[model samples]
Target: MSMIKKRRMIEIQQLQDDSEKQNVTRFILEALPQWFGILEAREEYITESVNKMFFCAYDQDRPIGFLYLKETGKDTIELFVMGVLQEFHRKGIGRALFYRAKRAAREKGYSFIQVKTVKMGIYEEYDRTNQFYQSLGFKEFQVFPMLWGESNPCQIYVMTL
Candidate 1:
């Protein structure tokens, strides 16, 4: 069988219930400490996701990845937080969630979808993250050297919808 056909199926769906969203966010983030090791930030993401647009990628009933979108401007939506279990990395689950995010933004009439991550070159794990966002057509918008702390300079990327 081809590699694609050999892989298990994954489904992406928007989560509506507040409790489910928080639970899934916590579950996925806990499995990805390399990206979400900061307890305060992780907790904030779990809590705030209830109000933002949220999507979860599941293998059967188990959540393997998730993405959250928050309206940052009248015409801009930010990819507020996202995580995929390490085992599922580069397996198209993140890309699938991203396409869903782009479709949601375009359907909502947003002009831009933005994402922020630790600047590339500062960390190995985040460098792959930067690459992933760039590969998905997001371009560098700006940088906030102290936003996440001097050790983790924040790089912002935006994709026009």
Candidate 2:
């Protein structure tokens, strides 16, 4: 007899309510220390304005990853946060969320999608993050020193489609 194995399914959906907001914020806070040198309590204000939020990579209905995107202007979108639960990292969930964000941007008629990352600090993952964006066709467009604060230098990248 042959046995069949089922593959895990992932679903991406916009966060639609207060309950989802809490879940998404919690996920970001949990992932922030590893990616951001310092996590600020005030960042929740930005999260609350997430124009587009994606919940991705679920295992039997349990969320394993999420992405938060915000609009910068009429024709611009910014990737605010994208992260996967620790157990689900390196499984392509991040990339999937990225593509979804791009598609959303395109649908909204955004000419450019921008992402900002710290240029230096304990956040060495910024390099990898920048490379990942470049791999997805985004290019370095600008660099702002102390953009987020007195100590954080930000590198801005833009993808034109």
Candidate 3:
């Protein structure tokens, strides 16, 4: 049997409109099942904050992924959240989104980009996720146990450019 190939039609661009915002939020909600309970902040709050400086990935005019960054300090930026539609995972969309975020951070004069992840039983893909960041040159700065709360231990990583 012959397999049909899916074209890689991904495009990266800054999320600038309300429709894009809704698409991103919906994608996040669908991609991250545990976000509602584990994350202390509301999705809308995070989306609004990130919308101020965010980039999205679209495939064939459909929003497929997003990467959000925020200036945390004078020379530092935080990668708040990044995810691709579940079906679109493992298709290089994450890497493309990351590069876009990094470019934006560099443009903003940030010297470092940071990300934090929690160590929870539900996050079996943590190792893979961390490895992906490290592959992109991020270094582990700190790993705090139960930092967010009694049950949420976190691993903080940073990439210096």
Top of the candidates by lDDT: 1
Clashes of each: 0, 0, 0
Cand. 1 TM to true fold: 0.95
lDDT of each: 0.93, 0.70, 0.75
Ranking by lDDT: 1, 3, 2
List where candidate 3 sits over 4 angstroms from the true fold: 1-6, 34-47, 120-122
Over the stretch 63-155, how does candidate 2's per-residue lDDT look in tens digits?
777776778898888887666776776678788878877887788788988888776343657767777777788788887886777666888
Residue range 14-104, candidate 3, lDDT tens digits: 8767666656756665656654344445455355553467788888788887877867799998887777677887778989989888887
User: Roughly what TM-score does model 2 have, to 2 decimal places?
Assistant: 0.80
Every model's TM-score: 0.95, 0.80, 0.83
* Candidates ranked by TM-score: 1, 3, 2
Global local distance difference test of model 2: 0.70
lDDT (Cα) of model 1: 0.93
Measured on C-alpha atoms, candidate 3 has an lDDT of 0.75
Model 1: pairs clashing at backbone N, Cα or C within 3 Å: none
After the best TM-score superposition of candidate 1, give how far the Cα of residue 90 lies from its true spot, in angstroms.
0.9
RMSD of 2: 2.9
| lDDT winner between candidates 1 and 2 | 1
Error of 1 at 148 (Å): 1.4
Kindly list the per-residue Cα lDDT of model 1 for residues 44-135, writing each as its tens digit. 99999887889999999899999989999999999999999989988999999999988987998999999999999999988999999999
